[model samples]
Target chain A: MTTSQNRSAFLSGMLAMLPVTPGIIPFAMISGMAALDAGMSPLTAQLYSVFVFAGASQIAAAQLITSHAEPLVIILTIWIINLRFVMYSASMSSKLPPSSIPKALQAYVMTDQSFAICAGMFDQNQVPYENRAMFYLGSSVIMWLIWQMATGVGIAFGSIIPTSWSLDFGVWLCFIAIMIPGLKDFPAIIAALVGGSLALALHGLPFNLGLVIASVVGIACGYLTEKKLSSNLPVKSDNDAKERFQ
Target chain B: MSLPTLWFVILAGSLGTFLARYSFFWLSGRKALPEEWIRILRFVPPAVLAALIVPGVIAPGLETENPLFNPRIIAALIAITIAWKSKNVMATFAFGMGALWLLQYVETLL
Candidate 1:
């Protein structure tokens, strides 16, 4: 890619991220409050925002801590909640500048928003793979700064946001926004039903271990069934031409 | 504030991030992610979500001393329906929260 193109892509990605900036602050603040409510100190909460910017997983982990769930269970839940990132990171690894950026920096900046913006461009195949990492880093740095400030605000005013209002629902809304759009096929439908039912059935299990089991089972069912099910769904072959196969 | 809990979140976050970030790099070099794994990963969000939502909606105040018909659940359902039909976040939040407050107001009437 030419230097001009690189600058253009970077500029576009950053611009696309601007609209989501206003939401990030409150989201992090709510998460910070969750950390505090779960007995996490202010410093710990801020550090969590700085390091682990995965918002949903942080709340899930904090909830487990408040319940005094087993440490392993808490860890396992965090892992499960974050498992999707495995796909994101893998997709991005090839796109990164393999030598200039160290593994540590890549790990830190790997996040949902970063991955989404990067992947959207990647799917378009406009930007070369080598420059994708810088695009991700640029966007992630901005998000990270927003999150840190939001978390600090939440910690500073942990007293104000009335628990009764349940601002935490924003996280749920965000997750739903992310999840619902992806449910565009039969496998996803089956996965959601089967996974949700299994989770409900297993809720009595200690330490929220049931969540892990249910998610795995749901994904397994979805995977095994998608081929037979999605065979009938419309599919397009290439971006150059719009031809649908049924 | 405890040392153990503090260390655990940090260690888990760092290790989790590293493992997730690297998993693709290592795997993509050899072969495409098996169709099964890809399909499986697709369900993670729903599964995690169900795990999160069902408890809140169906069994709110499970740990609270008293459990009853929760207005929050009612509001959530309404919100979800709005979210589904419209796919609007602001509408979902407004209606869901509005229902909760509205229901709470009705409860006082009875």
Candidate 2:
């Protein structure tokens, strides 16, 4: 792709993430308030926002702290809630081209919103190989900025936002909006159904392990289904997917 | 939840999270992921998304009680259709939130 095309890819990356911003604002605000309610100094709250940037886990940690949960329990809970990131990282690493941006920075900026957007783009080959990293960076950096700002707003103004708005649900809507496009195939459909069903059945599990278990089992189910379906077909190599990214 | 302990948790949590995010990238390094693994990973986004979205709508706040009466179910179904057909985020949010607010409003009257 030309420089102009790569530039457009970056712009598109940012544009794609824009819709998810509304969903994130309320959550970040809540994270901010939760930190304060847990008795962290404002500086430490901001530090929490900066260091452990994962929203769902951030709030979970705050609640854990407020309840005087053990430090190990808090870390373990956040880690469990975030194990899905390891899967995303496994997937994203393959899509990522070499970059001057440190791997540390890349990992730090990575979020579910960025992962979903970049995953869709790379899988569809809508962005060229040279532009994939740039595109991913574009989406992730914007989200990092937005998250920090939203947390700051939350910290500055506590409980001011009404629950009546149900803005939290926007988070799910954003995921659904991006995810619907990927459901055009059978394996994807199976994955979603099994995953959704298992999550509901196992939602009672401790520390949100249900999500982790559901995701793994659902992926395995989808994988096995795909394997069985494609048994008669020729084996497709990783290069084919890599070529698509190119 | 002492002062030092809170800071320690923040530091420790930060370290753990970064590891989770960085795990595969660090291990895989320059190697291309195996084909089998790639195939499995293809389902990651879909499965995870469903796992997240389904609970948020059906159970809302992780409440495990029977959602037989929850309006969120109806709102989510409408949103999913709009998301699939229109492929427009704004349209999904507008109609989804509108359906939800409308349903909740009607519920209050009854």
Candidate 3:
């Protein structure tokens, strides 16, 4: 691809991500405010946004910190929550060419939005394979900057926001927003309901292990449900059902 | 958690997360994850988020007393409706927070 073509691809990738930006602002703000509420200094809060860059995991970490959970629990929870990235990376690897960018840097900026945009564009042949790296960079870099700035704003104004407003609930609301969209199918609904109820039932478990156990149960429930459903239907390749879960 | 412990968690968490993100790229020769794994992994997000969210709304902090009257539960009910109907993140927050504040105000009057 010519330099001009690469630039255009990059610009288009960035522009495509514009619609997703507003949705992310609340999450970024929540992360920042949660961090401060959890007793982290403004600098450390901002640093979390900078270093972690994944909003859900950052919020989970902040919540665990504030609740005085063990450090191992906190770390394990964050890692488990982020395990989806393994699937994302694997799905993206075949599409993204080697040597397009440094592996470490590429991994650093690989986010849900960026991965979605790039993968969508590539699948639709909107961006050529050779130019995908440029496209990925364009989308991810802007998102990184926006996340940092939004988190900074949230940190600056977190204390000013009154407790009467009950913005702390916004944290759970954010998770609800993320979760509801994923409940498009029966198994997903079952996973969420079972997982949630199990967590509630076992909430008193020491060290917050209930969350981990519930997650395991929920995944198991969903997997079994999917297997049962698929078995009843005609056999299909795994790829055909891949999009069903996501 | 202590300062050093928090720092260690952050650093270690970051390392683990980055490795997960980098694994496929480093193992490009292996191709994608097995189909079974992908199918199972698909449940992770919803499961984890539900596990995290439910307790917060219902038995927040694992309180032993009645949780039915919790403002968060009512607000979450509203939030889930908005999330399902609107599918707008901002709308979910606005309606959820508005519901929580209103519920809290009502409790104060009682």
Candidate 4:
């Protein structure tokens, strides 16, 4: 891509993240409150966002850590929460900058919102590879900065945020924002139904093992169905599921 | 709540988060993930989300489990239905949170 084209792609990606800012505000606020509720420091909470940007995984890890859950258990839960990122990463790797873009930069921008916008750009075939990375970088920097700021807002004001107000609902709203856009196929539909049912049925399973099991079973069902039903199943790419998400 | 404990949580949480994010990258470099494993990753989001929501929307307390009639869950169902039918994020949030608030209030009255 030309230099100006790269700059425009980056600018457009930043613009895309602007819309998601409104959704993330409350979620991050609640997370800050959660940190206080867990008796954690603001620095620690902010650090969680800085080092580990996955909001759900951060919450899951925080809850477990406060409860004195085993290290292994906490690790497992975070892994499960972030498994989706593998899909994101794998999808984008082939379309990224060839060499000058460092692995760390590639890894950092592999977030849900950034990946989505980047993938969307790619899908539309509007930008070249070099520019795609720049776009993702621009998008992710905005998201990451906003997330930290949101967490800061949460920490500074989280305790005062009223439970009665149900600001916590924003977390669910954010998930919906993430999920709704991808409900595009039959297998995804069936997997969601079946997987959701199994999860509910197995809700009482300890240490959130039910979550892991349900996810496994659900993915298995979807994968098998796709393989059996789709006459032209695409060959498995070099990247695994986790790679795709990352 | 102790200092050591809090530190433990932070350390554990951070380490856990880092490992989870970095693990697949390291593993994928060494060997190819089996095709069977790739197939199973598809259903994870639905399953994990269900696991997260079902417990909270059901009992939110100790003792016996509740069923479909459970008000919190029923309320969530309403929200999910809105989400499915409308695919409107703001609408789904409004309905789901609205239902949860209403249910909680009603339960208090009873």
What is the clash count for each candidate, in the order shown?
Answer: 1, 0, 0, 19
For model 1, how does the per-residue alpha-carbon lDDT over B1-110 read when each residue is reduced to its tens digit?
Answer: 36786677667865875677668665645665654455456567766766676664555456652345566667777866776666544555567767877877776676
DockQ for all models: 0.44, 0.48, 0.62, 0.36
Give the i-RMS of model 4 in Å.
4.5
What residue runs in model 4 are displaced by over 4 Å at the alpha carbon?
Answer: A1-7, A66-68, A228-231, A234-246, B1-38, B61-71, B106-110
Off by over 4 Å in 2: A1-45, A54-100, A111-139, A155-158, A206-209, A232-246, B1-13, B24-29, B60-69
Tens-digit lDDT string for candidate 2 (A81-183): 5665776777788788887668888888898778876787788888878888878988888899889998998788765757797655655665676567667
lDDT of 4 at B93: 71
Error of 4 at B16 (Å): 6.2
Among the numbered candidates, top DockQ falls to 3
lDDT of each: 0.67, 0.75, 0.82, 0.62
Give the per-residue lDDT digits (tens) of candidate 4, residues B6-85.
56555665555444444444453455444555555545665565555554445354355344235556666687777667
Top candidate when judged by lDDT against the true structure: 3
lDDT of 1: 0.67
Alpha-carbon interface RMSD for all candidates, in angstroms? 4.8, 4.9, 2.9, 4.5
* Off by more than 4 A, model 3: A232-246, B61-68
**For model 4, what TM-score does chain A reach?**
0.83
On residues A1-246, what C-alpha lDDT tens digit does candidate 4 reach at each position?
A: 577877787787788677556666666666666666666777877776776677776765665565555656666767777776655555566456564556555675456656665676676777765577777778887877787788899889877767886656556554554454444566766666666677777766776566667767777776677777885665432222212222
